[model samples]
Target: MIERPDDAPGAGLSFDYAGFGRWYDSYRVEVLDPALVEVEAVVGGLLRDALSERDLARIRGPVGRVKSKPRAWRKLSHRRYVDRIDVVDDIPDVIDDLVGIRLTCTNRRDIDVAREVLDALPVADDGRARLWLAPDSERDYLDRPRPSGYRGWHVNLGLAVDVGGSRQPVSCELQVRTLLQDGWGELTHEDTYKKDGELPPLVEVLSRRMADLLSTLDDIAEDLRDELDRLDEAAVTSAPLPLTTETEGPGRRAAQAADAAAYLGTRWRALDRPVDLAALAWELQRDHGAEITDDWFGFGTFKRFLSSAVPAAEITTGRNAYILPADPVPEDDAADDAGADEHDGDVPDGDVGGHAESDQTTRHGTTGQGTAGPGTADEAEAAVPAAARALHRVDRTFPLLGHDDWTRLFDHLAEAWRRTGAQPPTDRLARRLIQSTRDRSAASGPPLAARHVEAVVRDLVAEGDGVPRPADELAGTYATLVQQRLVELRLIGARNRNARAAVRRWIAF
Candidate 1:
């Protein structure tokens, strides 16, 4: 009766312990691996959708195929068990599961975009996320940069997911960044974020400085990219002219070819043309003439022409050449000897009368055909010189007046002055003259009388005397002049509020 039972002795207990060990191994294989796989697939899908929505093409490849690798576990053998005999209680409540995704990009901006895309993803209520750019990552090694200098972004996300049908949750981690950052991280991860005395003081300081320098260099590169974009836009918008039969009339065509040759040849000459006149003229003839002829031309054509005809350095430096039209002469006069015979005309004998006739004759020879008289040519020529000189001065002083139209107008005024022997008009008078001329041309009619231009000029001069005209005040005067002309042309009523407002804005800088 006192003999040990077959199922109750030490031998039976040993067999039970062996069976429990086998069951624990089976749980890890069936439950833990599959749970981790599911979590990884869900998170990966979330990241891919976010990046795709943001149009971040660079991160698409890396995010779409992310996975959790090599499941890891920590055993809490001493912890309380759920049941007296259950081994599941020995497992820790939170598993330190880690998953990461890597992205590659050409520039740092792409890295930033990836980081933003990840942050925007919908996270579980119990999850937490963090983002780091460049140097903040573990892979960033300032002391030793990679040969390729690949820089990138990083993100650390903490997610909580259900496992094994348990009410409790497990924690998981996620990381995102570029290939360059990943490489850098791999190299320096051990030395970074060490609480122990792993990283030496000197190395840490040097690493920080190098990181700062690299960041600054990246910023500079971005700025250069922006500048290149602007230059490309300018080039596209400023392509060369075209040539066509109607546009390339024999006479104009010859003149255009000669002008182009002159422009190319003058590259070696000093840029001291009397008013950028030569440069303005050449552009007009080449651009407008070729356009008229329906001849297709581009930057390459102009560049090639300049390369052969002009100095290489001048063409490289972008020095422009202009070819102006022959200065407009009196209807009956020649361009070169226009005012030379002013004193030869029949004249009344007196300083007042003779001087007045001589002045009128000189003005007549310089003004455009059919636009000269007692007061017309004198006022027109007077304003022309000052406007031309002002434009020239501004071009040299400030960097404005780069527009071809503005420069061409200046050249025309200078030519008029040269042919008329006229003095520069006051600024007020010059402004009025320009406005009147533009208005008349737009209406396909003759300009206002020179006396009328003079009156407006006199009013402006009086107003501007001893006072710096605020930009608005000057603009207002031009607006008034435009409105008055528009009304005189009978195209619009004087009371048109919309027209007045538009003119005001147009005349404003």
Candidate 2:
């Protein structure tokens, strides 16, 4: 346990921002680092032993971090705390949450269970532990959030460490929150937007409104879980027979399952280009006894099936995987040539592999070199999709798409624009999407595969019900309508030679 000295010579001295800094640097290296390591080891081991797999899955993160040096100094420099202290000596004595762990859960019940587990843990004689419930001000936020819209529970614990035979207690803080509260808090983090712990009036009002909306969403999630449970019970009683009964042998069943996904995938690509994921999910539940949730992995499985079956699907692995439409063949070739030419000419003076190149320009603006530029092409070509996807506000529900699904979509869009002799949409959303892909590639490496533009077009398209339909029916009608529109435009533009040329260029493809 860390204890402050009361009778120091410079007791009650004014805040010395530099004085605190000098001691903290050395203290951190010699004392804080080693102490934190031991405490974390103890806590981590305790958690591993105590929690079951199901309990562990319920938790999002049990991440621990030492309070950064700068943040520590900022706390100590405060006049109120320093004024109470006699010559502020140590960082730990001033800041209670020197080492901290944060845990996020899906609901209030999970939060309570986690807290109970922590509270029941054993502590050695050398250590001291204390847990503080949020005071009235904070409690109100949990029940009815504050103006800043922050809602979470905080607990502070101090564990004793033996440094060269003497036992010293180091402080650690634990924060617990529901998933909804955690998401809102992260998006509007105090450190990111608020300086000096103050929010502008407008920001405060908006945040409060967001908090209310988030609370409503949380309630909806709870309702959904309840409704799903009722549905699950109904499904148990009346659901179709097991999929295995549909075929005679296990091998045949497996083959049929695979074939079903492929057949459905073909229809989806031809009709919608991108698979109608919701329809796919419904089909799986209705026919195949597969339960799909809205989580990343659940949706990812759906995408995986679609990608395998449909030429349009794209898939990626790891935490931030996603799918989008594929790139056009001509646009891809054009961009590849452009990227290759740029790479050859633009190698910086010192770096070997364009390492020193900071801002490599592309058709999408200044993304680093070796990147496919933005709009549809950019999404398919991004080496790291997470950063780019975040920038574009892409849905994060699915972790992977059918492989090359995004590539096909991009290619079709590019081809359509080219054939029409009209530019593809280059609005703010498109630019941001492109810029993000480039930025991600620059930071990371090149993408897993260079998106291929040339892919076979299928005649069968999937309906919203995930059923196959003939593309010829729609294609013939669509072509005739477009031709009529083009003729009308040509007749109107007959008076202007330039307009005629533009119209001809558009329809020539």
Candidate 3:
């Protein structure tokens, strides 16, 4: 327990501005400021990241504030310290709301998500979280409203603040509230919360009545949001079924494989882009009441892929494995080329490789090499890698094909074959479509479309349903689509498995 001074009720320590001000200023500069920065960086950042742009649009702010000298003095002068916090040593705990970070969400779900982000925060390497919720510090005003009708959720967060050179533990408060609740609180904040004295009967009754009405509004908004989300979900899940069906061929194999999403390439499966260990650990602790450090290793996965190669070699595998090749393959020209252009097809961060790209720039910007300033076409051609130049040769000769362009061409090809009982002259059709797409590439379509290839086989044999359609050459296209779908499904399955495995590891931890 902190030994606090119990000064006189009237004007005691209130008039001594210099003494209080000096302490307050030093405390604010040294302790409060760093704690605020730490909380905002860790808590505020995580909350904002948890919410999408749509959610953020509805949310007001993760805004912060510091308690003034008067508020701190008022709380400290109490006979027993507010929550028995040390005023001199633990100012942040004493003035729990010394640094207030408010995230006023428009609805309840966003508020819930914001709180979950903090509640499930993982501890750092020092066996501590940079900012953490202090025990017994949460106040659910919304669930149990105050007498004066204020509604909000608050959790006091302890921060590991680094003063001049040493580590100082400090704390702040995080407030989450719906827009309506925030408005109600705003109206009654001063009247209800500030003064220690009792409020008038009329004011008290009206405030409670107003709060109940706004609470009703908040509930309605949440229901409406849930309804809208269900509708959107239903629409997305209602994608068109596969174009064709097959029973006794590659198409059938593809159909089965694609449906399972469990047969993608081994390398792709292994590299399901590892999940955040901290997040995984946090989830484990929250859901299962198991604590674990955010440390994950992929040695098990590595052994699964490459252990067979060294079974005959006498080696005892430990936590760390150092594997050397029994026979090194000689590097040839093809290998050299492959190595040089290994990352050629890769999509850089923020430069996604897909159609439906609007105002999109490639690894090479708008006008290939445009982002690389002041270079003539000849100069660019000279400077550009031979591999890259070769990669783009086909695109320069042929016009880029958008999703619509490919669909139209495919439809025409099928129609042509059906009418004549023979493959049509795709050269003329291809030429015409290329020109059409080229003319409108800038005006109406993605400029870098067709940089990658993907075939979706939903809706080929319009009559297939789930049964195998008549064996036709056109059905071969459907087979190809099925093949593509199988690969995609495998990748998806691998990712799902990886996620599950990650969670399991955390659970074990």
Candidate 4:
């Protein structure tokens, strides 16, 4: 019988092929290698195509990899079969994560969205190409996390591929997690610590603490997204355009700005990430003197322009990465200031090269002519005190921050009140700002730093007057006039026109 079975598959009669490394290599080269690429491509394409452009922008990566042969061998070696067999013959049964996809998104919402998309995907085989999707392989790890504070959604897909002229089922694990969760996992590598042995007491405690904090930050991100959604709905329904003006010149400018805002709002609404379009339009007009007329704001032109101009939300795994909710637009160039409020109403024409109209202006000061020119005027303008520049930047950044953030900003402003060399804040908002700043200082550890004070001031100026609308409309009209008193004291300075105007506008609000 032995002589007759000399050339049989498992002729050597050992399940552990310790000396059959060459046969394993032959199997890898002949069968597994080609199938790896096919399986990976099919699975990866299915997962990546499920999300739209907007969702894709928020997520970081959808990386894919195939399990290596040595790892597969180690897995197979751990198994004890009832009868002797060839290692290559048993490779298919033991390997599960031979092909894998790891999807890392920016936030919790995206991870959830991915989960839904994967659940509905149809699985297929290579040769006969049968299309079928079977359930019961997914684990909801986010909802039911491990005792070790690990959180992610794991999906094991059983796929069949044509390997060596036969249909073979391959198991692939797909893991979905937020960027933050993935970062934590990489920092405290489980293989290095957990797999090695029992965790040390201090390391265990720190890991739990880190997990809790990251989880809280994730919750905060989710809440922030919800708040933004509420804000967008409010903006579309009732928030009035901020471009109110009566004079023909200002009114024309206002109309142009409104059109631009409307266009942007409509486009973003379709993607479910609407911004405060009115606020954005107002800042572009008032700060940079941008001309958002029909020629420039047309569908074909504006969409392409905004895609490049508007900065996207920067996603990161750190806590301090939030640099205000919206992107900041630079202040207007001097050339644009030369044609301020020009009543010609021509809707100026060109290739629409820049956001603001370009022209030559006298530099020293405002000319007797209606428009200001470049020269010493621009030099003087540029030489405005650092405080004014700082304030302008703040206004640009914070014009639409929430009311609570503004309140915290007011507290900081009061702490720096003495530094401004102006009369102590007497108006209700100013007094409240100072009082709150003091109260917070008393409660917290230390007074804010000089840079922080400047940041807070800019945020206050950016906010202009209220959380959404004017203070009276949003907060029932406060009695204290903070910015009005500051203007009366001339603390904002007239060295910079934009800064001075922004301070006055806040007073009006």
Highest TM-score against the true fold, candidate: 3
Residues 21-79, candidate 1, lDDT per residue (tens digit)?
46446754655444456555655565554332223444544532222221222111112
lDDT of each: 0.36, 0.43, 0.43, 0.43
What are the per-residue Cα lDDT tens digits for candidate 2 across 342-443?
453332211111111122211111111111212222322322212111211122121112213333233333333233332322343233333443333334
User: If both were scored by lDDT, which would come out higher, candidate 1 or candidate 4?
Assistant: 4
lDDT tens digits by residue: candidate 4, 360-471: 1112222111111122133423222222222222222212222233344444444444343343223444444445554464355333322233334433433344222322
Worst 10 residues of 2 by lDDT: 454-463
Residue 320 of candidate 1: its Cα lDDT? 25
TM-score of each: 0.29, 0.42, 0.46, 0.43
Better of 1 and 4 by TM-score: 4
Model 2 local distance difference test score: 0.43
TM-score, cand. 2 vs. native: 0.42
Candidates 1 and 2 compared by lDDT, better number: 2
Query: How would the candidate models be sorted by TM-score, starting from the highest?
Result: 3, 4, 2, 1
User: What would the per-residue lDDT of candidate 3 be over residues 1-509, giving only the tens digit for each residue?
Assistant: 32334454313233344555678899888777777667777765665544433445667776787777776776665545544543355444455677778888878766655653553332222336576556556676766788877788777776777777777777677888998988887887642365454577888898889999999999999889868644432322232222233322224334432322232233223321221212222332343342111111111121221233224322223211222223221222333233333433332212111111223221221222111111111221222221222212211211122223344334443443343332233444334333443334434433323221111122332313323222244335443433232122221121222222221121111
**Candidates 1 and 3: which is better by TM-score?**
3
* lDDT measured at residue 20 in model 3 versus the true structure, 0 to 100: 57
